[model samples]
Target: MNTNRPIRRALVSVYDKDGIEVLAEAFKRQGTEVVSTGSTARRLGELGVKVTEVEKVTGFPESLGGRVKTLDPHIHAGILADMTNPDQAKELKRLGIKPFDMVVVNLYPFADTVRSGAGESDVIEKIDIGGPSMIRAAAKNSASVAVITDPEDYQLAAQRVDSGEGFTLDERRCLAAKAFARTASYDATITEWTSKHWAKPGTINVPPVNADESNDATNAAKTTAPADNPQFPPTFTRTWERAHTLRYGENPHQQACLYADGLDRDGFAHAEQLNGKPMSYNNYVDADAAWRAVWDFAPQIAVAVCKHNNPCGLAIGETVAEAHLKAHACDPMSAYGGVIAANSTVTLEMAQNVRPIFTEVIVAPDYEPEALELLKTKKKNLRILRVANRPHTRTQFRQIDGGVLVQSIDRIDAEGDDSANWQLVSGDPADRATLKDLAFAWRAIRCVKSNAILLAHDQATVGIGMGQVNRVDSCHLAVERANTLADGENRAKGSVAASDAFFPFADGAEALIDAGVKAIVQPGGSIRDQEVIDAAQTHGTTMYLTHTRHFFH
Candidate 1:
């Protein structure tokens, strides 16, 4: 180890000049020299630090338009040499290289430049040639070097380097670990960008042969090709970021988060914190469920009330206020401490009505000033969010055992076409209100488990039979709840039903139909779809087939 090396010497170069000058000045005050390269040298010199440029140490001018500034062996050997090895010390001495005990570096503008709509060539050029090399070198010799990346590290790094001594062994190890992660994220960004431009983002809606999911074999490049491109088949994929954290998860002991798609990171409507405290995990999850349910209505005012990821109340009215009232009336008990979401703005009258309810969140496009004040007075802890446009992206993810499962978001209910594979199995076609109730029931059922059944009336979920051991038991449970919530008005006696998957036999449907489930909706892919149809016909019940099955487990 070069025993004659100075007690403190730092080489500082960074793209973000956030706290560079102060760090440089501190290094100088500690009786240690501050060496820099290119713009860093000029910036530190301007700050009146006796800055030594890289060219002065390496004895070579930067060529290749200044890209060759810090690629010299003099700088790298100092950072990479094994300080514990006497042979490495002798080699460094023969090469006349001084040890660099500290290297402060942040990468080139690649992440920022590519994030902007920069041209492909411009983005490729921004990848740093020497910064990552220096960082990796210093990190490799962390036992003898201190490396820092972020602006938050400025004070700690300066104190360690000028703390009447120098950095301890453990601190250098932590700094080196951070440097490695910084490089990894940088490389991932570059890889993502290469995939974006090479594969061509937003190219789709074509036949298999004509599909643009293919690329030219002759132009295949390592960076441009995906991680497992042609061998595994490249399916078009999209991504969205976590917009906000919720207060809590399904249970208080668990945690949760929510995300809004179809908006850039800084888009105004994407989880805008217009008012109130931060949301909880459960609050965010239910709010997302509510908003996603209502966005399907599009260009109209519809309200959804969600608790535990299932909509308890939902309604569409001529005005937002009417929708809120009708939906609130659907299941007043379930709506307590739930999440409310609508497709339109929160009006003063609607907010006035909603203010009395103990809701955890209210999400919409906007809120009137009086409405905001009214809601603010109701609950200081309530969370409010504004989102613009319909959320159209359909990416759902689940984490399990160090692997992530990605699937298409449930979109079967969006079509509103219950007729294609649907059966008018009973005596007559449904009325407008019955049809609406049937649609709502089907949408809610699909969100449940495989052997799921939903009984709904008055535009609200009467009861949901989820994850039952048998289809018959699930039907019985749903019918019982429907009857219990019927208000003795016989709503369940004339209500609609929905199932996520087809019943293997007709008994489940027959039992529910006989129990006064007037209509039914299920995916009609089973071989016995005809028998189920026949049973519904015998029971004088109406049936519809979604064809697309929603089997959540």
Candidate 2:
């Protein structure tokens, strides 16, 4: 296994012919027999590179619309023959099959076809079948066969063959592993496409969302499908392509990497870095949290400052600059080095307002010229991201000890209209001015962590309490922070409160009322809802029941 094996017989078939001519020439110079199929063989012949056709190797012309060329046992036996086994060598010799010492192949562009919005028949025709089979057979016999799928590896293979030193077993095995991964990803893509577009009316082919699923090594790396349909289908296959590697995970000692669903836009997966150092693993997480929060309240000039995947402060203002200032002021200490994101473009004034803050990352739809210039000059190492727009993605996933917990993304409708979906439950109906503030608070609270309470005034978040054990504590924490920020001005006196879920007890409502919170909005589903409403009525605090709980745990 340690010895180098010379490449004698090579098969080269590819849909991407970018750098294959040089590779084929290198193989020819090494005296290797270059075999190919259909267009590839014709293209190589036109390039003055000699190549043996599949029909010549298999003794049968390609049929079934050129799909049955390489399915013969002769070609597969040649690719799969083991050089180290005497029996396999004797069998290949008896069958008159010339063993393939190398295989260079790239599959058809099924993914690209799907992306091109091609017809179903066109997309299906683009699925490469024999190509994957040849790659797999050669890869499995890596001890004797050198499998190469990526063109980037052509130079290294050529150098080895031309050096007269031959290909190393380790190189073969490495390429074999990559070949397997490539085929697996390809098949997974086809499976996903077919399941989505060509499945029977009653059948689905997705993995079931189960909390008690095993942490099997085979399922270590998972893919997230659309949460709109989370049922386990008849056929389930999952694969992901790595986006990038980060220096470390949440902690410095842990390892981490990023992956995407292959969509080119719509989320942070394809975010463009205008300026700054490379993003950390945690930076991606925090940036996603902030960006999603901003879009959750879209069309409003909103800003959300996030730390550790939870919104510390979020607000809506007349301008993005004012929004950033208000959101940052909610918890300046926590926002010191947090991630800041906005739903709209960041203007020059907004950049100036954020200049003093020691922010780690800033993300927005776009940046004005002055804003980009000022931020880039002020903080040479700050990570800035422009996502351009927010695309609707349905699925959300969280990895646990052994499995992934999959669910639908929280989408709040009727966020702007309080009277439409909310009921006046206690005290008095909110006035137009109070209702406007309550709407702002409701949208902001949706992004906070579980047991969340947000105190908002003047259409901006003043204080937020999140990740608490109980609702009462969160209420108290929000009011206390608001009072502290006021520093004697009594900011909470005319402020409104938004709760992520129903308060189980009346004490939570009482806590906000005692702090001079004039109005409150929350999902009402608790058995003690009447008691809570009575508490609000006793304190003369206006309360509305949204009947929609946004619990982000």
Candidate 3:
């Protein structure tokens, strides 16, 4: 079969007209016949390029508010015809239908329209019918027809035309793959939006049970099956556009690429990189973890230094610089080469403090001009990103062996901050200052991995121990780091500790108390809760039960 096919006759229709003039110029230079639809015909005409309209080729004017133009057999036959086949070529001649050697088309901005909060009717109208049909038809016959779906590829298509070589078989196949991906993502977006808007509670029909058979089994099955389209639908489809290929994944040996959800949302995916090299997989993972950690202490200037997707140091202060200083003090050894995130703007003072440190990435809502300049000049390898303050997605997804686990994000609610709701289970009640430190530790602990233990003083973590198999080991690790890493004093002395979950045994609470933790907070639902409470009382450590576990696995 012939692989090289020249773009002698082409069909062009697009909603985004960026770089279309290049293709038009190529068509004119190559003396190629162009058939365009609706505004595209006018656009090419305005560019001083002569073009035949779709109505002239199809002998049918566009109807249904410009939705029925390209759906005709005339357009699809021209696109899909295998001209190399002698019989197909003769049929095209018999019908007086000119085959299209190339199809340049881009679909309507349905995703963008839906994201813009447009009305239902307006969004429905934005879903392209003929556009996908033409794209798919041309792509299916990629050996004979070249399909262009992105404006970025228009220049390449034009260059191929100008070179008079058209597209190679390899190039055509690549373009076809991209075209199919575009249509697939478009359909996925439409499916997601429509499901949310149109889905209703549906009932399942059950066969009548025999009089001797048990009705209890049937009743249980009915209750287990979803009666309505809840958060988890029967079918789930999500689409992500490839942002760029990363240098590597978590390891240098693995290949990886970044994908974005194609939404105008505030997140690390949409963050603006102000300076430094491209981010790595580990950098992004740790940066996002750090960002979420700091933001959990919202309305206050907070900072978090994360390593291996775990918060190593976290703190709140009057200023971002102060917060960084205190947070860095929490485990300076671990903060080295870590990703840092600030809830407030990064100041010059903070940049100066961070300059000496070999940090991987630093992300904040914004950065002072001078701070950004300093980092750009000094830290050439450090990734500096500016994100916006907004609520993150409520749902979180984690992949398991065969399927994904979906759950609501463990957001630190107002109750976490309110010590009033906490029960003073053991020892005396904490004072306002001690209660404030307890609250900070509680909020910060949510970012730690279970079994997690955090020791904090003056709104700053003194030590963090996480991802241990046993809670007792985590408590000991936290205290050991706090005392051994302190500059001149025992950092755990008079400090408060927070556990992500209840202590299954008294040994965990005893370890924290023995390390000089003055106060402790935990969910407190273990069967041995009384034993842990008694241990805390014996050490005169004030322990509060939140009755809410924040186990991050």
- The clash numbers for all candidates, in the given order, read 9, 1, 0
Q: Which tens-of-lDDT digit does each residue in 1-553 have in candidate 2? A: 3568877778888889888867767777877788899998988888777789999988899999977779999899999999889999999999898998888899998877876778988888998989999999999999889998999998887887787766788878999999999999999888777766764555545456576867765345344333334344434476666888989999999999887664233457778999899999989989998988888677878999999998878888889999998888887888988999999999999999988889999999899999999999999988999995695666566889977775667877755235477888787788889888898888878788989999898878888888899999998888888878655566777889999999999998898888889999998999999999999888878999988888988
Better of 2 and 3 by lDDT: 3
TM value for model 1: 0.81
lDDT (tens digit, per residue) of candidate 3 on 1-553: 5578888888999999988999988988888889999999999999877899999888888998887998888898999888778999899889888899899999899978876878999999999999999999999988789999999998999998898878878888899999999999999888777766885644554455456756887756545544353455666687877887999998999999988766445567878888888998988899999989998888999999999999889999999999999999988998889999998999999999999999999999999999999998999999999997554766678999999976667898747446679999888889989999999999999999999999999999998889999999999999998988777579888999999999999999888898889999999999999999999888788999998889998
What's the lDDT for all of these models? 0.74, 0.84, 0.88
| TM-score of each predicted structure versus truth | 0.81, 0.87, 0.86
Question: Model 2's lDDT to the true fold?
Answer: 0.84
Single out the weakest 10-residue window by summed lDDT for candidate 1: 260-269
Off by over 4 Å in 1: 1-7, 57-69, 108-129, 200-270, 388-394, 413-441, 444-451, 456-463, 467-469, 480-483, 527-530
Q: Give the total clashing residue pairs for model 2.
A: 1
Find the 10 residues in a row with the least total lDDT in model 2.
225-234
The residue pairs in collision within model 1 are: 246-280, 246-281, 247-279, 247-280, 247-281, 248-280, 248-281, 248-282, 422-545
lDDT of model 2, residue 68:
78
Preferred candidate (lDDT higher): 1 or 2: 2
- Name the best candidate (by TM-score): 2
For model 1, state the Cα shift of residue 113 in Å: 4.8
